[model samples]
Target: MEYYFITGTSKGIGKALTEAILQNDNTYVYGISRNCAVKHARYHHLHFDLSDTTALRNNLHKVFVPLKEAERIVLVNNAGVLGKIDYIGSQATDNFEFVFDVNVIGPAILMNTFLSAYYSQQCPKIILNISSGAGKRPMDGWSAYCASKAALDMLSLTCQKEQELLGTGVKVYSLAPGVVDTAMQAHIREAESDQFSELERFKLLKENKELLDPEAVGKKILQLLKQPQQYSSVLMRVDEI
Candidate 1:
């Protein structure tokens, strides 16, 4: 049997991924979220604010410590925050800190804690960080979101290198799920019109109807996890799939 750990499973891509993975009889999914409404015999739901690194680390250890040896263990760091968008000089310092805490620091601390307890002799482990195109390309009012994702991408790369050095059978990846229809989109679209240039771009895309389904993205993630050699250390975009 294969076991998967995922965060932000209350909604959006995270919820979709958890449901899709649970469809397979051989898979067990452990989901972390602030709230989880889905119930399944194979699903283990954990509730916590991921922005708290120490608490997250402690919770992760408590959860994974009891799992039996398995052939594959997958960790998806999917929880993230897109703080209120504002012009670079106008944005509050607290906004940047909050974004970084959720998107970058939270995942990094989780990975470190998971690795410290994981004995890879039982299975090939993998870490998937759900990044964004905002990390690669700049948008005027998305400074905090972009910067956090960029740091996450680099952190994934650094983790890949570190895993190779340690000779651990663990692979890390940064994946972009494209523009999916989610609550996050609503937040982006609602940002101050003058400060957010991407608003028009997104509006245009929506008008032209260019939004991907979250379930489709989730399915692709499952496929990638099953074929780790094909995706290891790569920044995969849903559009490319």
Candidate 2:
């Protein structure tokens, strides 16, 4: 059976991906998020707060059995935050730390714990971190978000290299989903122009109806997961697929 462990499954691309995975035969999903938005026999909702590392570690027991038993296992670190939108000088220090806690530290902890728990498994194990193009290109007011994704990408790269040297046969990738129509986008569009120089660009994306749907991006992610052999790069862009 194909098993998916996804974070931020309450909404957006994570939720869409969870639902999409469940549509396949013999597929099961373990959704970790604050909200339990979906109810299905194959979908198990594990209430989790990405900001809390202790809680996440404690809850590892709840996911171990499925991870060990599944024929194919996939972990999608999809939870993230944009933090406060403003120049670095004007940004709140607390918000900066909070963003790293959720977007970088949380996923890193999860990855470490997951590897410790199921590194010996013979199944096709995949780790897909939902990264962003912001990680690659410097943004005007997205300092925290950009840094967090860049860290995640580096984490994936390092893990991938480690697995390669160890012959673990696991596929690790930090995938950029491009511009999607989600609450995060809404938050971006609402940012003040003075704080976010590209506020109008984001607003124009919404006004021009140019944002990609979360569901479509979710499907593309699934397609890539199924054929990971074809993907040679650990840093992937959905538009390139």
Candidate 3:
């Protein structure tokens, strides 16, 4: 049997991935999100929000209960938020905290618990941190989003190093799903040109029908989980898959 623990399952790529996993036999999914929109015998939905890190920490022990029956375990930290778009000093200070809370703190908390909870499970373990190109290249008015994702990439690298140092067979990747047609893009396209200088680029991407589908990205992610050893421990970018 194989197991998948995913966040942000209420919508977007997380929801698509969870549904895809349910189609497989002898597979189980432990999904964390604000709402449980999926129903299946093998799918277990855990209620939580990434923006609320306190609740996650308080209930860390409650997760990963079905790991013992699994031959392989995969954790995908997919939940994230794009904070209000504005110039660095023009945006509210709370924007940074809100964005970092979901994009960074929540994933870190979940990664810690998963590593510690299933440390002894002799199985193929992998952690996929859904990152973005914005994390690698700077974009004006995306300060909070870019910073949080950049930190996520660094954090994933650090975790990969620590796992290797300790001889844990866990592989980690900070993957960038380039320009997916998600609600986040809608939010970006709605931003005023004053703050997001290159708002037209995103608008044109939409007008030109260039946004990638979430379902397609979900399939590639599933393939990665199935054959993780074929890729590098710290490799990234779904386009390369």
Candidate 4:
């Protein structure tokens, strides 16, 4: 059986990804999130707040379970928050901590747990961090978010290097899933023009129906995983897949 532990399974791309992975009867999914939105025989939901790093670390045993004959294991760090949508100085300093806690620190802990849990398991291991294009570029009001994702990208790359040195057979990737039509996008569109310089552009993208569908993006990610060898870069974009 193939086991996949995914974060943020309550909504958006995470929920879509979980549903897509469940299409196969031989696969089992452990979803980590505050709430559950899917009901399936192979799906196991674990309720936890990603921001609470201490609780998450203590309860990771529920996510990484032993399998009789596991074919593969995967970790998808999909949960993220779009911190305060204002210029750096205009937003509260605490917002940076909140954003980093959810986006970078949470995933880092989970990745560590996954690696340690399956240290001796003789199966293919993959870690996919759901990053954003914002990480690769600077935006007016997205300083915290962009910085967090950039940190995530570097973390994934550094982890991949370590795994290679240790011969751990782990493939780590930090991928940007483009602009999906998720609640996050709605939040971006609603940002005030004074805070976010590109507010009108984001609104136009939504009005023009240019945003990628969450379901489609989720399926594409799964397809990309099928042939991981074709891509060598640790940092990637969904469109490239």
Index of the highest-TM-score prediction: 4
Clashes of each: 0, 0, 0, 0
- Cα-based RMSD of the predictions, in order? 1.5, 1.2, 1.1, 0.9
Candidate 2: tens digits of C-alpha lDDT, residues 99-206? 998999889887887787787778899999999999998998899999999999999999999989989999999999999999999989888898888888888888
* Tens-digit lDDT track of model 4 for 133-225: 999999999999999999999999999999999987799999999999999998898888999999988898999999999999999999877
Question: Better model by lDDT, 1 or 3?
Answer: 3
Report the CA-based lDDT of candidate 4 relative to the real structure: 0.92
lDDT for 21 in candidate 2 is 89
Q: Give the alpha carbon lDDT tens digit for every residue of 1-241 in model 3.
A: 8898999998888988888878899788999998888899998889987888898898887787746667889899999899999998788999999999999999999899899989989888999999999999999999999999999999999999999999988999999988888888999999999999889999999999999989998888888888887888574898878
- For candidate 3, the per-residue lDDT at 70 reads 74
TM-score of each: 0.94, 0.97, 0.97, 0.98
Off by over 4 Å in 2: 66-69
Kindly provide the TM-score of model 1 when superposed on the true structure, using C-alpha atoms. 0.94
**Which pairs of residues have clashing backbones in candidate 3?**
none
Q: How accurate is candidate 3 locally (lDDT)?
A: 0.90
lDDT of 1 by residue, 1-241 (tens): 7888898998999998898999999999888888986799998888888777678766666666556767688889998888978887887878888889899988888788778767545688999999999999998888999999999999999988988998886899899988988879878878778888668888776677787788988999888888888754467787655
Off by over 4 Å in 4: none
For model 2 the local lDDT of residue 223 reads 91
Pull out the clashing pairs in model 4.
none
